[model samples]
Target: MSTVTGSTTAAISSAVATTTAAAQASVQAAAQSIISGSTNSSMDTSSLVTALVNSKTAGQAATIAAEQTADNTLISAYGTLSAGLSALQAAILPLSDGATLNTFKTTLSGTGVTATAATGAVAGSYSLNVAQVATSQVLTSAGYNASTNLASGSATMTLTVNGQSSTISLNSSNSSIAGIASAINSANDNPGVTATVVTGSDGAHLVLQSNSTGASSGISIAISDSTSTDDLNKLAVTTTAGKSISSASDLTGTDSSGNTINPSQSTISGTGWTQTQAAQDSYFTLGGVGVSSSTNAVNTALSGVTLNLTSAAVGTTQTLTVAQDTSAESSAIDNFVTVYNTLVTTMGSLTTYNASSTSQGVLLGDSTLSVIQNQLAKIVGSGVGSGTTKTTLAAIGITLQADGTLSVDDTTLNAALQNNQSAVTSLFNPTTGIAAQLDDSITNYTSSGGIIQNRTDAINSDLTSLSNQQTTLTAWQAQLTSQYTAQFTALDTLMATMNNNSQYLTQLFGGTNSAGALATNKG
Candidate 1:
């Protein structure tokens, strides 16, 4: 408690001890207040710390913003390029297949028949007259009690189909009618025959039918057994008529008037089995020439045409026409043109500059993109064949437009296909075709380790680097905040002590500066 104001200033100055020049200046200003004995003063530490931290980290924030923009643009570019290349690949797949080009289309004028023409079929029209279609052999065994076992001990049955024979064993272990039917159906080598046990109100009857549809493909069954010959022989059947019973049995019948009477009924079973329906070849005529087929699907009667007989009306005639499938060929070329245009448009967007954004595209100046664009333009216009009438894509229907997209002239393409189909096909030859060349070019960019993949990987690496940089910037900002907060708090503490000392000095002495009063009083 000194009456001299200069002594109060000396005490406050001695308390202000700090290494930073700014912190020292703040403490000195507080000392001056004590000499003047003033109390209306404040040190806003919170506001000062906020300002200092912001100023220190502004450069890093700007860097982060720029990096984020670049990362977003690059990611978008990869997606656009990948989708564009995949679409181009799908558009040219049909033209790349040789089988599709050689395929012949067939048409039928009559509802009685359908036709399919194979590869290399000559373009021609022929009249077809179906006399009778092929029929399969059918045989039914005598109705037996379904629960009864028909065979005793062991017996072997031989089944023949289309001149091929397979033997099935019949024994007490599989002697039931159901068991025997299952055994015949499950036979590993059984050819063109299926055995089934059909149940009716009378009983269960074993029905054996030929899987094929001709006399040469009929089924023949024979039993080799010494015992139970009567039961085993019942399963045997022959296509040669009259070898077994084909006679009528008297059955109870009901008339439309509801009167019960005796009616003659034909039975297909006896001591042995006989054919109910004989296997016969299909009879038809091609261009008034007689022909025969063992099956309804007639393949060999014509050179490359296969006729399937649906219904046989002896007097009816149908027309079968085989011709080049020009529509299919044209459609394939059209698809290729469409996909090419899509790819070109996407690439243009990715490489174009946007004045609104004041920025160029992410891939604007990429050398790889330039290479892809130049190569694609060259491929569509170049000639693709040597010994062909149509040499280039432009010679046909597909031609490049001013905007780097492909356009098709359908009339021109169809004429080329109609005139020399081989030459048109050669233009898309698997070895050196327009479609092949385009496919090759697209694969270079879309396949593994391609240019697009490499570029994507580089962008990903850059994103990783950016993430690391953001982390480092965040840590640097945190450190700066801690440093600023500590310095301002220290300065505020010095100023508050100085203010308290000044108030005490003014109460003991006066509110105004008293340095001159102290010197005169000392004199």
Candidate 2:
């Protein structure tokens, strides 16, 4: 027992001395009770066994608990450190890649025209005059009854738009005007065409409109009906190339019968189609040079800039000015500084040690945290390059403070972003920027299989070991309790028998001055 106790004590030398002393005192008290009670009555065997078992296992149990607590604290501390590093990484990613620094903004002087500038757009001012906005071709057929059958037996209607054609089978089931419109809309292979029925004062007019805007996106329909003179033949029309019509007068004024023509109604002439609206391209001028676009959104006219023109922009001249966005850049840099300072503060609290109060942080002497702090400080305090052209955070009004946090001067930062954009770009270059370096370091520290994860894994392993040790100690304690209980109970029975025997002997053979039965018989 002494050898086992010595070995256990040496293994858990860091266990609290008071706990071990208390266990020892309990065992001593139980032993004293047995010794003093030998002359009086049988000892409390159950309490003696419990005290002995507790004395043997108390140090090991306390050691396991303390070590497990320390390991858990370390694990939690690593989690906190990892979280701080991740937040800092998120704040610096955009700056590191130069996405935040290279942003551009566009200013337009007139209404109905909006412009957006992206990367590669140069700073400049240009005059833009929009002559016409693009429109889609809309063709309406002659008026017909809503329920009138347009086709007889099996027939096929092929609709073409923008050089792409789709043939939909039109039979007696879907030969009506409304049925034809529904078939056209539900056709899976439709080539950008929408059909609708407009109920005017005359009757229902089948309207076919191109789904796209441009000169080539005109709608044309061809029908092969069972009969030559079927009503479906009236729906057959050929595409007409769009022309620039400035006013209603530019359209055909009269039909062959000298009747005043209604341009809104379909008057199938030689082309077999009526053009309610032309499929003309958008016409605009940039810097006094004429340009045409198939859509209102003209992206090809300017490098890295898209111009959105509305109908109201026609015949109006607007000024488009492109410049770098300074405010966004400033905000991004400021956010980076703020997040970095927060990380620094968190790290300080984790690793601080108070000498006067004798209170230490959970990770006060952790080497991993120390190394991480040193690496970050080295990068932040150093400059990107050497010589006069070199730039640093200090040059951009971001300074490292005595307490390892950062301070930003907004006025200086804005000035640097506005005037010295090149230097700023160089400092935040995608490859060698300070933010990029910091991001890389943080990734290494916080990523899977990184330092923090490895440390946490090690601590968890220590906890598992402590649990196993605790399990073994509990088993030993149970075994020791059983053995002690048996031995003490047997000793208690023997002592009780001996005490009873002494009383019997005193009664039979009288002591000192008392006569016994044996003495009386001898006299």
Candidate 3:
């Protein structure tokens, strides 16, 4: 009996152990199946969620790409058009004004004078005789040792020229003649006076010069000293009754015209310096007529010619000739033709459609661009002036080619300018000519709220909408992913729970065999 009891207990224990092991294996398999997902009864949640979101958002992504591409193309097209228009505008400028059209070339006969001609210069010859060039007033102080301080304490000096006056302050650094010269030069309110320090065999001295050249303008200086016997006063003859430097007068000087300054008791007294050279005006003759000018650059004698007199002699003369500049007019027209042809070619290539090549330009078949091209053609083809003397561009050698660009006949254009300069002037005058019309048209297309700007703005707006939609789709995809993941995770947990319960029941029943039967068999 004891042997049977022990055998029955061992058989039951073995059965229970086998069933428990199988149940655990099943529970693990079920958990793995649920987490991995399957077909039909279960769902491949991750792939489905990604596929659905991608399918819904694909159209929006494609639209964004298309808008971006279109915007890029529009930007490129507008930039190219603007560059061409700018070039055309520059070409139009030289021909628009009457003053620019009446240009003249000037020639000088000799080295004594050089002349420049302006638009108003009438074609004529002029003889120029330079008698005397202009001069500036110069005053020199008596020589002193190089290291001598010209200032005692702080002193103020006044310089007057050309009805203007400036006060100069002397400090320690500017106590010497050199430093004083620097200070005078650096004074902000100084009208037309300059100072310099000159070194001679004897010693250094201060020299003051007026920048104004004529007799009407000269330099005057007065000094007031606060310390000691006034350094500036000591440097000159003392005017005070008993002060003992030279009693003679350096303050008594002559004007630029050699007129003497009358001596008076109030006049400041002398230094050893003398009036070396008097300031004089430049004397010259224009067109055989005697003329005088305060400056060497004589502009008033001739209508538009400014004569820069380089030398002065009593009988020496120069001939100034002003003539029409036909070559300049021809060159300007030629440049216009060249630049216009280039602009037309660029725009043509952009707007044309090619049957042979599959590629199309960014701006091909654009209606606004087509209208602009038409307007340009009309402006180029239209007659320039009102009269019946063949005022159209064809008469001036600027003709439109079949490909819609301009061509220039240099000989014809030059001949036309020579024959009728006024007609040419009227052709491009900004007030009432073809160039004015073209300018107005281009302004409408290029300025603010213009056609090109409006198109660009619309494209930008579309791109912005596409960008916003893409953002919304992206957020929706993330939400879908989270929702799917949570659903699948919960399903997996439920499946695992059911599997665990089945395993527990199978172990309790011992897999279709009773525990008692197994114990009896062992007996």
Candidate 4:
């Protein structure tokens, strides 16, 4: 009875072991299937491709268009001043063989001025004293009407220069020491004489000054009006010319059109060159309204110049010369045209249609770009151009083509340049011409939302989607791993128990009955 029961148990154990092994294989197989199908990377790249279909592709094309537009703007701007550019660029470079910075000492001097302080900042006649006016301090000067205001208050004021005498009037309110000073300086306007109430420890005193530095430039002031009076209207002034012979006077120059040029404002003259002074020049106004005794002109004394407020004098006007980068401007113009021509040729070639198959090129058939290109052509053709100096594109190397593209007809351009230099110089100079407009247009296309924007946006959007998908996929993978682990572990435990019982039962039989052993046993 024991033998028969043991044999039956052994058979049962063997059957269960085989079943457990099969179950493990099934569990693992299922796990693998789940893992394979559940991986998030399994999503096709085709979907990403689909999402990037339209404007993204167009944006890539826009980069090329944008470059062409930039080229056009530069070239159009360059045409008017091509020749000067190379020289200007070269001159800007220092002898150090690289971009070099240089420090320079500049001195201001003219014929009529005496500088008290030679260097650094000192109290001054002129107040270059930089005062930051509070926004609130800006008195709306335009609203004040000078007609009703008292001019000056003083009795009889007489001025004599080299025995030439003039009668002057003065009002009390307008001719306080400050008013008399103002009137004296105002009377000496043509002679460059300036006056002001000089305040000292004692009290306020009327002081006279001149615009020139030399002995011939010294001016004398005599306050003939004993009673305080308004004295501004007392002196006579010449209509067109300025002659400051006294220390209180200042120099004034005017263009042929009678536009007065103040030394304080203009850096250059009509010819575009800096002014050269053999001696110092002085600036002054009456009653200290704009005059001062400090060595400085406005606030601090100007270097290389000396000013003396000894008396008032008529001052001479010095012609101003403007600084010009003619050579650099010329070269810049030439480079611009070159870039422009190259740009258009390149763009048209890239964007034009191919007579054959489905191979469309960059910017091909882009209508908006075509319009922009035409606009550039017009600028190169006949937009705002510099007058006289460089007025035409052909004067440079740029030539307009029948097809709306421009070319560097070097020979024609060189001739135009040689024959009419100013016309060529005026062509693309943006300061007053078409180049400015075209440059502005180019700016519009490259900014945010320009051609490159859409493509960049698409790439960013796609990357964001990819990141989200990865997160979700990673979570799915974790779940799959857990499921796989649990299923395999259960199978492993069952298999181990089954194999142990099968071995024990088989051993108990000693060698089970021949047929049963043969069916279940392994070699």
Candidate 5:
């Protein structure tokens, strides 16, 4: 709307504004870029450091993955070994050469058995020499006078053991048959002494017997306190201060003999504590026939254990048989198969790769996985050392599933155990069976180019290459952005200087020209 000169003035002002706006925009863009770099794009190093640590083994995912790798090896070994063992029982034969006639057996009749003299027979041939489970001895010190209730003569008696001694004493009130036993037992109640009251043809007399059994249970009592009738004939107290048997449980003290004695639990019923006789060989029973002890025959050709039981004295050899547990063996085989299948599947997942996927997921369908599967499949079919019977797991009850998993055939396994157990034992036991064979195989494979080892090596190599590429990409992006900023900033600065010079020239000409001089004169 203004005249020509005014329009020119407005145009110059517009140019200055445009130039200043351009410079401001360029400066702002540079500032924003620098801020953005400091806030988000610059390499802070902390994140990369964390990533490296995570990649190495600090993070949960990496640590667990690494640990699982080691665990798989050990678990696979155990599975292979267990699957190969043949089911068997303990090797020790029951009731063998150590057999001895322990019990006297007879019908309801009071008739006794005729004891035969064998190489092991101790004293009598037809009759057995059985040790006393319990005994009562009515002992009266030779020096002791029953009528006077005191030591009548110079007979002496003493009980000593373990350097401690207590002379036997009896009060007149305690002179009664039961009373004397009660008093002696009370005094010797500490450990080694076991005295009880028993009534027999001799009336009630204090029965003194060693509580210990065999050579260890003893009763040592000397005649130091002896009188003619009351003198102890078994033991002699030395001139030294006699240490008496202080307790019922002490092994060193006894009544008269040099036997160790320790009294056991005392009950009120007839079932009082008694010395346990040495356990002798005894026979178990079967069919009404009394199978003689000799029938318990054990044959080593079977390589299995045997337990022989007897019923009676006049019996012929009646063999008893123990069986191997087929159900358990089947279950164990099933577990091994299950775990093995899992391992196979896991291995497949590890090696298989999908070409369609741009992202790496699983390493399935790999050569390493195939090798692992082949090695494992061979284990079930493998044989043990010269095995006549037990060989294949499938022969017992193990079967593979459609998805390459395994299932146990319990029915077949049970039948095998019932029909032929020796074969089963040969198959599983490691000492001579396939179970041991598996251990050797696992050891061979996991050594170096083993499936797991080779796969791990490959994955690690790939990770290293991927990491290097990621670093290069980030650095290239940063360099490109820096180049773009430099080019744009230089162009903005050049535009700002040109616009400023153009404004300065327009103002100078308008202020000093002839038109300006004429205007001033008219004013």
Candidate 6:
């Protein structure tokens, strides 16, 4: 009996423990009641079955739970590390590409003049004097009756400005002065000309203005009258034959009727149109040299520099100084330092160990995190070249700290940008710069299918595996419950039957506390 019991105990120990103490206790109570011959045949066989099943599967269940928890924590830790790396990447992008360091600022000593310098602009000062601003041409026609028809039949009016011309056909429908103005204003192929009608006491006058400002943007109109009676010839203006209305001498010409046209007696000059404003180019001097532009916004005068001119700046000399934008460079470097320090802090927290408290970070001693930290530190501390050409962040006021962070010296940084811009450029060059090196490394560590993601994927796969194990354990538990329920139920009935037989014998042949039925009858 002892051997069989020991073997059974060994088998039970081989399985796991997942059963509640209450279920085991209920089974024990039922067995005790049967042994004591209480005549109670009912037993909590379900509790006994549950207790046995849990015991067989508890170990595997605990193992799966532990592994799942560990995998999930590792995944979360990698997520935090990835976020830190991405932030560091963003902070270094502009610096890595050399955009931040190549910036320049423009300064002008006078008002009404603004300038901007692009990447390739040279750092220097130049004296700029605005002689005149560009002006657009304006031509006003002689007044005529607004409702009177100008074209006797179908005639064409050609409007030309800046060498481009548009011709409109006029008949009885649009022959009036206002109709002609509207037709010119609404023509789809109209050149650089805007037409408007100004109604004065003298009747309606057609005004034509150039859309652009320049010497070449003068306006000219030629009228093709269909017949001799057509009044469309009254709007003809010609700049050919040196007969521009803007000339100092009053232009002289003959009217359509072969009559001598005098400027003093007519509102229109002999050129057939009155000049309100002459088209002219903008004139400015740079370093005592003359420059001209068709527009006030001048970009071609200086390389990588554009000057915005205004009439208020005319007749005055101003100084334009182009220099490296040290402020922006400094700010960018400072931001890099700040974000790098934050990354360092995050990494430190992730890998921290506390001997006194007997505790450590979740990702403590992770090989991937260690490699990333070491590589970043190596790049940040390394110099660019060898020997005399060697340049490091220290040369530009950025230095590595004892706690694995960076610090900046503003005065040194500004002076380096102002005086030794080339050295700064070399230090932050796009291909071999410190920021570029770090950016490349971070991309490898945090980008899609990179180291961090690979690790996270592995952990997720492990979690799935753990989940499968849990499912298998659950199935095994169910099987154990079914088997145990039948065995325990049969054993319970056998025990109850044996207890009842013992009770019947105790009553028939009295033993210990009770006399037998035959002995009581003899007494």
CA lDDT, every model vs. true structure: 0.70, 0.79, 0.67, 0.40, 0.39, 0.77
Candidate 3 regions exceeding 4 Å error are 1-45, 97-99, 145-159, 166-191, 221-271, 312-315, 387-390, 475-523
Tell me which of candidates 2 and 3 scores higher on lDDT: 2
**Candidate that scores best on TM-score:** 2
User: Which ten-residue region of model 1 has the weakest summed lDDT?
Assistant: 241-250
What are the per-residue Cα lDDT tens digits for candidate 6 across 1-523?
Answer: 0111121232333332333344455556655544443455566677557655655565656556655666676787788999889998999988999888878899999987999888678778999988677778788878888999888788999988767899999987798889998899899989988889999999888888889876677777888886866778878875422222332123245668988752211132434478787676677788777787778889998888999999899879899998878888888888899999999999999888666643467677787888999999999998687789989999988899999999899889888988988888888889998888898899999888888888787777877777777888888888887888788778777878877788788788888999987678884
| Clash statistics: count for each candidate | 0, 0, 1, 123, 69, 2
Residue 504's lDDT within candidate 5 is 64
Candidate 6 TM-score versus the reference: 0.76
lDDT of 3 by residue, 52-156 (tens): 555545445544554555566667777898788878777767765445577888887777677788856888877766656666666677787777677767887
lDDT of 1 by residue, 227-271 (tens): 755477777665432211111122245758988632321123345
lDDT of 4 by residue, 396-501 (tens): 5666778665567656655654465455435434354445545554545434675333433443454455456546655654565565456545655555566667
**Candidate 2: tens digits of C-alpha lDDT, residues 1-523:** 1111221233345565667888899989888769855886669887789888988888777777766666676777788988889999999888899887778899999999989888778788889888778778888877777887877778999998877889988876777878888899999999998999898887778788888887778777888887876788777877665544444333335667898643322222323346687677777778877777678888898888999989988878899888899888888888899999999989988877665644456667677888999999988888588788778888888888999998998888888988989878877888888998998999888888888888777777777777788888988998998898888888888888888887777668877878666777784
Model 5 vs truth, CA RMSD: 19.2
Where does model 4 exceed 4 Å of error? 1-326, 337-395, 399-411, 421-434, 449-451, 498-523
User: Local error of candidate 5 at 4, Å?
Assistant: 76
TM-score of 1: 0.73
**484-508, model 5: which lDDT tens digit per residue?**
4465456445555655665565554
Alpha-carbon lDDT of model 6: 0.77
Residue-level error in angstroms, candidate 6, position 267: 17
Candidate that scores best on lDDT = 2
- Poorest lDDT segment (10 consecutive residues) of candidate 3: 238-247
